[model samples]
Target: MMDAREGRRVAGQRAEGVAARYLQSRGVRILKRNVHSRGGELDLIGMDQEVLVFFEVRYRGSGSLTGGAESIGYHKQQRLLKAAAFYLHRHSLWNHPSRIDVVAIAPGITSQYRVQWIKDAIQASP
Candidate 1:
């Protein structure tokens, strides 16, 4: 991979770590990390309040104009949706209530790692 691509991968991993920590702090139980399926790859999977949670971790380096959330385009969303379905079926939970979440991380000075957790980010077909 090129330098930019490598950097992006590293940043995404950092974002996932931050997101997982943040979710854990909120009492969410992590079930899996980097789960891949027909839909796409889910960065993190957890349980929160009796609901299955699928998370997408996005990160933007310092000095970047757009924030992390903006990086998640429509294609990414569609993949995540399909991935969620795959996960559900693989786990044999067709009727369980589930949700998708987005965790945006903006790394900067002072402390770095600014996180934004968006709940119910995307809806999956039933």
Candidate 2:
């Protein structure tokens, strides 16, 4: 039997996969998934035309109280920004245009999931 943690991990991976496919259909080319840096983990990374996109994937069960996107609070946004910065500095991609995006997954009425893709979901702290 899968443990709770393992189940959650599997669910997250599934959500990311769904999100990636949805983005691809909409013209985003995915470059990476599950990128782990010193600060945090990035669920997906892609390119939308000239802009590099860093994606944060959030999944919520059908019965959960908090919506998937709503769960990414202030601290989570900070961590994601830190991770994005680390990725940019490490890859020497600072000169490229980049933005953070969020893919929120939840149960849908007719389909398996309803995905909400928010562009420039979180801005870097100034």
Candidate 1 per-residue lDDT over residues 1-126, each given as its tens digit = 569889878767877888899899999999999997767899999999899999988877777788877887788888998898898899898799999998888875667667888898777546
* Count of clashes in candidate 2: 0
The total number of steric clashes, by the backbone 3 Å criterion, in model 1 comes to 1
Q: For candidate 2, lDDT tens digit of each residue in 2-106?
A: 999999999999999999999999999999999998979999999999999999999998899998889999999999999999999999999999999999999
TM-score of each: 0.88, 0.97
Highest lDDT among the candidates is held by which one?
Answer: 2
List lDDT for all candidates, in order.
0.86, 0.95
Deviation of model 2 at 44, angstroms: 0.3
True lDDT of residue 102, candidate 1: 89
Off by over 4 Å in 2: none
